[model samples]
Target: MQTYPVDIDPEQLIRWLEAKHAASPSVFRITAVRATDERMVPPRGTHLDDLDREDLREIATIATLEIAPAHASEGWLLTVVVEDEVGPRLPDKGALIEDEQTIDLVTFDQEFIRTGRGNASVVAAVEGPEAEKRMARLLHSIEADRHNSGPAKSTD
Candidate 1:
């Protein structure tokens, strides 16, 4: 696996994933951004852009990890939410991330500033096919809006 700088720009991260998709046809991207509402109340779908400002803030702190397995059946994307909430059912039903994993968060909290690798890893993880599709869809929507806008005319 190739290694990249940890402190990566979000846009750069997306481009990297796009490259990965081009190279590997089977690999899929899974994005795990932070959750804004402790309640986990998102619009209820795969649309990452639907994530609100609060959700983005929460995602900024935690690394959004994505993994794509070689086998299609085995491939599944998830958003890992790092917090104190641990139990059978999460604290809030609205929170979509219903699972948790034990990771050395020292890197996410204390060491990212010094090493910069923690956040970069998070961005790297999301570079997969699924992620590319979602990103493309969102971009298409934005482009459609711009195209639909009427041409500008002189005020004079």
Candidate 2:
């Protein structure tokens, strides 16, 4: 296991995970970031993108990201929303994440996630094989979209 200092760029974190993925296949779990309802609520677009500051504020917090590599160029992004509601469920039903371990969130810098405050804005990649099935094993998604290098996705 490797150790990272407190507060690092989200991209750097992802890059580090990518490197780790290169070394060996492991699910890259990340901290949830604040987000706007635009993307969090469906119909959600396919593919992950960077989140803006203002946008990050509107969304929920406290969600853990479970990124499992499905392909060399692509992977599965599951936003593991805890059973704790307060978040608008995808179907508003029948889905929630369980028993997935996420790394330390201090590095991500999202206060809500780091401190376990609010709900969460999820962004999971519903592409590739076994995507739905994998999510079936685990539920409610596993990622927050606080991309790019900087402070927490949403800090106020």
Candidate 3:
């Protein structure tokens, strides 16, 4: 139940996630790719590496978490797209794509207000051992990144 501040480094977040899949033979069961700010605009094919930290901080973000289970050689490829938005809404989850094979979808909007002095809320639908391990790694990476980035500056 650790808490992550609302103002996280978007670029670092994406890099950490990408690193999970870049390991030898890829240790991650799920791979997450993120596009923040104006980089999410246009044809939507902008490379994550092409965007800098400042650009990431100034625009909206869309992160796609792609999962691959460990059983079948080609397991179902489910994609979870997380989009940033403003305003009010209770956190929840719903099906974006459901079928016999793939179950691609988006979770409820995990809001992070700039003025709010609190942690961002996340809702994960996936479960089981692999999923748990993946989540733990992601969380650990985030915490480490935050700490290494130094203290948070006053946005007021």
lDDT of 2 by residue, 54-128 (tens): 232122323355554443243345443422234433332443333333444443334444444554344456455
Better of 1 and 2 by lDDT: 2
Kindly report which residue pairs in candidate 3 clash with one another.
37-59
Best by lDDT: 3
Highest TM-score among the candidates is held by which one?
3
The residue pairs found clashing in candidate 1 are: 6-120, 29-128, 29-129, 32-79, 34-59, 40-94, 40-95
The TM-score values for the models, in the order shown, are 0.25, 0.28, 0.29
After superposing candidate 3, which stretches have Cα over 4 Å from the reference? 1-10, 29-63, 67-123, 128-134, 145-156
Ten-residue stretch with the least lDDT total in model 2? 147-156
lDDT of all predictions, in order shown? 0.37, 0.38, 0.39
lDDT of 3 by residue, 1-156 (tens): 222232344344444444443442243365555443332233245454533322332234455555454433322333344565432222234513222232222221122222232233333333454544554544565658643343222121
Candidate 1 lDDT over residue span 1-156, tens digit each: 222233434333444444444555344534343432334444445355643523442222344445444443432332222333221222443545434433332333333333443334322223456644543443343334332233211121
Q: What is the lDDT of candidate 1?
A: 0.37
